[model samples]
Target chain A: MREMIITNNPLVVEKYSERVLFIDGSVEQVLIKVRDMVHRKHGLISHPLPASLRVLFSPYRSVIIGRNNGDINPLQVEIVENSILKYKKHMDVREVDKENNEDYQMIDLTLLESALKDEQVNSMLSGY
Target chain B: MKLEIGRIHIKDIQFGDSTFVEDGVLTVDKAGLIASLKEDERIKDVQVDIARPGEKVRIIPVKDVIEPRVKVEGTGAGFPGVTSKTTQCGQGRTHVLYGAAVVTVGDIVGFQEGVIDMWGEGAKWTPFSKTYNVTVDIQVVEGLEVHTHEETVRLAGLRAAEFIGQAGKEVEPDEVLTYELGGMFEETAKYPNLPKVLYVEMMITQGLLHDTYIYGVNAQTILPSVMHPNEELDNAVISGNCVAACDKITTYQHQNNSVILDLYAQHGKELNFTGVIMVPEHTTLSGKLRVADYTVKLAKMLGADGVIVSEEGYGNPDSDLLMICKKLEDAKIKTVLITDECAGRDGLSQPLADTAAEAVAVVSTGNVSHVVTLPPAEKVIGNPESIAVLAGGWKGAVLEDGTMMCELNAVIGATSEIGYHNVTCRLY
Candidate 1:
């Protein structure tokens, strides 16, 4: 059997005893016990817990959870991978041409900053 | 010496009773005693060869003395003509008379004769006492000579239209045109020391005019009207009859001291000659580029002579100086570099201190025909007279009270066969 707990307070670490602890299944039973212990000791639950967390830890126990359950969903990861692939493809094309290869090199950012501040830079840049 | 009846003398001389002898000489003791001798009965020629033991020797005459007559003559240039006359008496004596005349002092005149009265109721002739008459004269002469030159040329400031009117009146193609630059003339008038801006306006209404060859330094603007004048002189500055139009431009490094380079560049299309642009060494790169652009564009459009870069910093490095020259050359413009090390304490540096030998070197290396530098007022030495002669003549002639004779000579000598261009004079 596994248990899960969720609380608004970050200083509830001593009750868990173990530094690295993971909980799975029977989230409802664990929340009820934690709530009862907090009520008996503190007299009241000052801050409200998240409604989503309450629902997941309600009387409904033995729920089936998916592997992808965190904030980073599958759709976000796919989008990030597509952007990296596109950048690599662009770099590969630029590297194939000798004329375009120079453009791929990184410019000295400090030189660009100084050039922007110079009054005559705009005139010279326009000339180029 | 003579012995008359009124005059007394001892030892075969005439004497009056009142005229006593002292040391064997006749002496006059009474004023009126000489009147007795005039009566012919008192005494005449009373001779005495000797004096008694108790008598005196020297004799004094009892008569008033008469002043001797003198004669004078006049000579030299500018003397008037005159005459003389004489009258004779029975005793081989003649009276001389002189006519009115002018003579200088120390002049000699002939003593013609001596005269006694031979006419009159009681006129008589006696042995005449010798007397001479001399004539005196006075004359005047010039002390100093002063020479001056005037009535040569007449110059007047006129509007563009006036010059056009005069140009219309010209029947010949080679006739000279004249007009004045108004603002320059006005500014020059305000400053007491600056040179006068004499503007010559040329009217190019009809003929095909070569701007450079037609209007030298004196020519400035054009006019729409032949009479009513406009003060917009700068816009009217067209290239006169010369291959190039150039002026010395001085730029300072201090803020707010920028020169209006556009004023010169505006007429770039009209100028056929190069612009000799000068820049101070310490001027910023931005300022140098502006000058360089102005010069390069004008030179490209017109024909740039060259760029002369001068460093006013006394201790500026030669490498930096060479770099400026190199930059100008890289721009495809000819470059001449002047170092400030030779500027000296007299405030003149660079080309001014360049000797003839150094000037030759600059000409050869820089490939420039003309060089500009300050007048050597600091190094100049000698008396002003010698300098004046060396300068070929005085830059200006002034009267004691500081009156300028430049205009006078210009007006007077303008029409003469000989022309005076740069001579200046002052008159009080």
Candidate 2:
């Protein structure tokens, strides 16, 4: 079985080799920042990504994320991977400051961005 | 978007010398309607009949139900991009022949079509039982593919409705209800203190016999998109599928979507009703993920604080319903989901095929597999024995005395997820 982890922080995407992670933004601020960046990357206008987004996780395509709560369905994971490959594109980026742990780590949306570009994840976001 | 629906309450329908409405009574030129519908060569024969609210009548193997409406002052006609003509809808004046519906019956296609009982114990379950139904008994060419057969009956119903809708054109309506929602941003500015909410309506788009149409286009071919709730009120979206009969939203329900209206009722007082976002319930895993994801994306784009998601059909579509709820709730957007259950006859099974911890507020429309018994109708409109082959019926569903026993699945709109009916379930 693929490994799984559930957390409120997006940095966990790179910290573990978990195949699936459920990011619960049970807190309002954590939830809003997570949503804003995901929408922005998809070409939708929203609040600017916090300055914290700049400090950690560069070379940012390291992990995939989704906006759903609880454990992800196995079938959904497979389809999301396929959709990611279909819409995959590359952009310039920098490496993460793994040692930095400030307001930066709390709202970084790189993981959610990776999830938004993921095939199944994209479908979950775009198809409906 | 804004619209004025002029309701001309229909009290009775009868065969007459011409088609027109007089003093709440609708008169149809039966021979003329049959002749017009027979224009389609695929149709072998056509018979028009009427079933009223208290009549001892049963219309079986039903395919679709449509309300007779005519766009009196709009860009498009009745059922824009559908039976009439293609044009934008949900504006101006449209006349409605309320309390009456055009019910299509006759030949069976798949095991998905249902029964409409006009009287007796069965009448209490189906919303169609309360309508003054003008049923068309159709006979398609023998050996026709199920696809062509469904199309034949579907078009027949639309044509008949368009024909009947003409009767209300020149008459004055009994009551007029107006629905107006300014631009989304404008509404937000007007009701700045209230929360903004959107509605995500998932349609069944599995295949030929399982589909929905928006302005004459199959929902399966389109991606998730936005629609003014008024467009639906103006007959823009229509039911073209023959899934299980109990929960399918007939065209009438689409024209009179209670969820949209209820939200509109509280638009300024309690909330700001942002428009609607439509998505299809696709059959494949990838399709499901794509639509579910996009649906949330649209809701987020619209800046919704709360949303109500309603699903069509059951089983697989439950995955899409829960997925939307999960994404929205995870994003901290409150959501309420409406769907029916297949909790088995004993009601012990899980209510949905998939579930998420975030899907905490769900409205159960009722169990489709729940069985019911109906005494034989004093007069049957179509085929009585068809119940045996329906989705929830067995080979011996019809008793020797002509009484029938079947699950709620065979009854049309018994558990409408749109909140059209009063039927619901509670744990015993």
Which prediction has the highest DockQ against the true structure? 2
Cα deviation of B335, candidate 1, in Å = 3.7
Model 2 — TM-score against the truth?
A: 0.76
List the candidate 2 regions with Cα displacement exceeding 4 Å: A1-128, B108-110, B391-398, B424-428
Question: DockQ for model 1?
Answer: 0.00
lDDT of 2: 0.71
The regions of model 1 sitting more than 4 angstroms off are: A1-128, B1-168, B175-285, B297-326, B336-428
Query: What fraction of the reference interface contacts is present in each model, in order?
Result: 0.00, 0.00
Model 2 chain B poorest ten-residue lDDT run: B387-396
Q: For each candidate in turn, give its C-alpha RMSD to the true structure in angstroms.
A: 49.6, 15.5
Per-residue lDDT tens digits for candidate 1, residues A28-67, read 3333433333333321111111101101111221111112
What TM value does the first chain of each candidate achieve?
Answer: 0.21, 0.22
TM-score winner: 2
